[model samples]
Target: MRGPEARPRFGLSLRLLALTLVFVLLAEALVFLPAIGRARVVYLEQRLAEAHLALLALEATEDGMVDGDLQRRLLGHAGAVAMTAYQSGFFRLRLGPDMPPRVDAAYDLREVGLWPPVGDALMVLTRSQPRLIRVAGISPKDPRVAVEVTLPEAPLRRDLMRFARRLLGLSLIVSLIAGAVVYFSLARLLLKPLSRLVAAMRRFEAAPEDPGRLHTPSTARHEVGEAERTLARMQARVREGLIEHARLAGVGAAVARINHDLKGILTTARLESDRLEAQTRDRDPDLARTTEGIAQALDRAVALCAATLSYAGSELPSARPRRLAAHHELTLAAQRLHQAHPEIAVNLDCAVDTTLSADPDLLARSLDNLTHNAAQAGARHLTLAAHTSNHQTTLTIADDGPGLPQRARDNLFQPFAGSARNGGTGLGLPIARELTQAMNGHLNLHQTTPSGTTFHLTLPT
Candidate 1:
């Protein structure tokens, strides 16, 4: 949908950009979740290592004991309220408060696996107040000894929160940068070309007949490029269709103007033919029969004239089949053609005669139209060849007149578009073909070239 009625909801470009950000942030979250958990474990391991070092400091002191002030200093340096190391289930070194203050929680670091629990880390981060936590693990300096530390979770949580802020800021920056890069890259590579196609459709919809509005094929070798090429072809056809439609519309208006007059003329001819037939009926049977055929042809003509306004709309009326002498009808058509244009010579190839079951009036009208078309095309000599086989009769109307042109041959059977000459309505062959089909038969151009043109008309016999 185009024009000024519907507003744009959102550009695909912006949606892609937003999706990129969301995806990037999700990727960062994937990294951030496990990383925060591991960060907690690393912090605990550092405290254990410091506790071991502090034990070494105590061993270096006189009597393997340190005063309260020095002990507190060592413990504070390790970021622990109390520190102890046990070898073979016995304490090797101990420092700080006698019992620490009833541990709030205890963790065996050795069984904590490769990384600290994410749930535990989250819990520390969410806790409102600091509480003591006991951590026990193999001492970093001596794996054979177990080290335990009493530490305040507040410090660990503070470090974790600080790390989160820094990481979150970094992730945002990276997401924005990556998102923008991806957005613009896709916009240039795909979105812009897709937009071009959409825009071409809208533009074409606005003015289909404007050749300038047709989509130009881009050299891109992708599916979109193929679409561009296909769109060009489609627009070309649409332009042709519009042109044909306009021609038909003009033809319709002309027909509407003349329909009444043409019907009046046909009716007058039918009445006159009837009167003539009545006058000659007893005197000359053949003349009366010929006059009857003329009146019947006029009746068919009036019906055809009524439908002329349809332009491609209505179906031809039903065929009223009758047994007729095929050879005689061909001769009659040939005589009519020769009389209309004495400059052309007409030959009949009526070696065998056969009875044909067809609407006599329709058959004559079709034959008349084909022969007249050949004559009008500047033919010098015409041949009406007839034969019967397999209960069907074939009439080949061959003309030696510069054949049909290539342009005419291409659209030969199409109404209003196959004429080679100027001011031609191009309905002759189409009307003939349609009449032939109405009789459950066929009319086809058998062959055409610079040498001559031949049309094959087949009917049931």
Candidate 2:
């Protein structure tokens, strides 16, 4: 047995066909009702006209009468068993035998309403046995006089049934032709394009990384066409993202290998720097200072290598939470910032002596990244301020820099794409944010304008 998706069933074509057929039949039925009624009326009127003409012939005779044989012939020609003519409020002529046993129904041809003829016609059609009906109308030749006739309902019913059958057959033919035309037209215009889109989506889903599997959208300027265009654009973006991910994966592998070898080299250089420092401490102070600078640079290099390795391995260094005085951490970061960029002025203002619960090293590293970024942006004056509010310690770092560019601000904190300065890897801010988050702290760029830029760092106190 086939599943629901695999089962074959009626589609839009069949549905449209059935709908068209039903609508056409309904329309024909509406026309048939009034048409049958009108047919019955016309039949009675024709019989009355024949009877009137026969009466005229009888009146033309000298005695205003006809032989029995001639009378029978006239009534047979009019298709009525009996007929009477009245002129000037007097009976002028009478034909055929006496009145029938009973009249099943009576109709006034001069009746004004729409439903009377229809009702009479329905009575005729529904009668179980042949009926004798009486029809009265003004004579066509003489408007002042009236003619009456009695006719069997069987003939009229037969004619109406024949007409109905022909109409039904014609309606079926027209519906079939119309449904075919509509089905093919819509199938080509709508269903075919939709089917193509579905097939394309399935193929793309099966192999999303394959750029060639993406759909080529239709150029039609319709709603369906717009959907196709949107899907195409989305598929393009997805493909680009996949390609970028693959490239990043490769770069990560290369960085991991470099970090492994470079760590050993930095360790050796650190040992040599320490040995040189010990030897020169008793001799030249300038040489000792230079060795100390070399040792500091080596330490920074090793830290950066470790950070890169950690990021590449998708493992952020876990934070060891501790309580530390906010003022002390701020002063230390400020002193380091000044040492790194001595030409830049530093101002530290701590109005709150708050102890913050966070990883001290991680907090200091985030502050260092923010200050170093400010210095690199040609900032001349850097201000570090701290305050405690609602059991939270907020640190504000403002700088008199040219401010970040719009592109950098948009992609800020996104690794490899957010670098503001040339020849700089865009990893600093993202790593800072990662470290801040691990310490349960928040870091954000508060504002950036032509005059300056500011950063906000918040930690629990």
Alpha-carbon lDDT, every model: 0.87, 0.84
Candidate 2 residue lDDT tens string, 1-461: 22225424887666766776687677767877787778778888888898899888887889888888998889888888889998887888888676454788777788736767777777777876888888899877779889998877788888777876786678778777877887788788887888888778878877879988999998999988998999999999998998899998898899889888999999999999999999999999999999999999888788778867866887666999888888889889989998999998988888545778888888988999999989998999999988888988888899999998998999999986787876556788898889888988888999999999999888888
Error at 192, model 2, angstroms: 2.6
Question: Which candidate has the top score in TM-score?
Answer: 1
What C-alpha lDDT does candidate 2 achieve relative to the native structure? Answer: 0.84
TM-score of 1: 0.63
Task: Give the TM-scores of the predictions, in the order they appear.
Answer: 0.63, 0.53
lDDT for position 454 in model 1: 96
Report the C-alpha lDDT of model 1 over 1-461, residue by residue, as the tens digit: 45644736777877888889899999999888888888888899999999999988978877878999898889889999888899999978888877567889999887885445777888888888869999999888888889999988989999999998998899899988999898889999889889899989888999899999999989989988998999999999999999998997788777766876888988998999999999999999999999998987887778767656555456555899988888898999988987899898988887645777899889998999899999888889999988889999888999987889888999998887898665466888988998999998999999998878899999998
